[model samples]
Target: MRKCRFAPGGIYHIYNRGVDKREVFISESDYIRFLCSLYRFNDIAPTSNLHRIAYDVRGLTSNISDKPDKRKRLVNILYYALRPNHFHMTLQELIEKGIEKFMQKIGTGYTMYFNKKNKRSGALFQGTFKAIAIESERYLMEISRYIHLNPLKNIEPEFREKGVENIDKAKDFLLHYKWSSFLDYVSIKNFPLLINNEIHKGYFKDASQHKDFVFEGLFEVKPRTCKGIL
Candidate 1:
């Protein structure tokens, strides 16, 4: 594990990969199912029927969006990114063991869905999701940048280390990627219901400002400076 501690009001960067570093998100349906799972299993209430509601006959992932907005969330999902093999998330704990509860439900629920659909068994994720406590405000932004920039791997596997070759192309790819909260943070409405954007209120003036920070600010930061966050 990277770092371990779950305290209320503490923010953490949580992540995990598939067993053997296999691809956990294989198809569009798989991605949508996992995304829906993030929404359905985030609450303090017991997740009944699980992914069944997320994939009913009428809709694929849209069905789960119909859930009422009143359910209490265990953690405030600050930022997240789902890659082909692994996943990243920055969460602000809202209650006791909030991060633990949310991670456990997402892991167990998604593994069952993945295994049953793929006709495989045993643990789907690695031992457990790792955690990195964000001790300061500056580290929070850096961690979120690291998480959102992860999709660069899909474009160029070496972008993280060598820096983006074409800034515009990289920015376009990130803006269009639907899996991460980058789009939402930019106020482009990727998955507004899945995240709590209120946290960015005092930090950024508006969406485009944040979009600049994500695209331009990190673009200039030498990969060496991003060592610990990356």
Candidate 2:
């Protein structure tokens, strides 16, 4: 486990990978389930079990249309991306131990559901999730790009180190990727209710500029610096 203290009002990059780098999301349903967990497990108060709710409503559309229940949130999820084997999030802790509690709920709850569904046992994640504090505005913006561009690894395994090979294809893939908040951040509003984008709204003039920043700006950033603090 990484040693880092989470503070209220502080932004941190949080992530965890599957055990042995195996796939955590196996199907479309699995991806949707994980996304639902992200929305349902953010509360400071104990709420209905997502697994039970999902079981009860099996075969129903996983698109959660209900408004997030009114309650104090554990953390403000500013940005997130769900990859095949891991997940990434940029969160601002709103209360004491907010990030810790939120991660615990999602981690434990998802692991339990996944194990039962797959008929497997033992730990699902590699270990304790990693948390890195974002120390500057540049780092914050850069980290968002890094997280959003993660899906590109599927087409270009070395994209992070070498940048996108086909800029057009990369942009298309990112625009269509359903598992990340890239769409919401770009103003498409896939799950606008789950994010607090005010902090990042001013960074880009509009969605087009943000798209350029992601696909173009990344190429200009040196690989070493682009890896960011995390």
The candidate scoring highest on TM-score is 1
Local lDDT at 219 for model 1: 61
- For candidate 2, write residues 35-117 as lDDT tens digits: 77776778877968575555212322233555435767898899898888998999999999999899888889889988998
Candidate 2 off by > 4 Å: 54-68, 217-222, 226-230
Query: What shift in Å separates residue 229 of candidate 1 from its native position after superposition?
Result: 6.2
Q: Which stretches of candidate 1 lie over 4 Å from their true place?
A: 56-67, 221-230
Candidate 2 local Cα displacement, residue 169, angstroms:
0.8
lDDT of 1 by residue, 1-230 (tens): 65677889888888888889899999887888887778778889998896445453234335445655777889989899999898999999999988889889999889998999999999998888888888887888777777888888898777766767888888888989988989888878667777887777778899888877777554654444356442
Per-prediction TM-score, please?
Answer: 0.91, 0.90
The lDDT for every candidate, in the order shown, is 0.80, 0.80
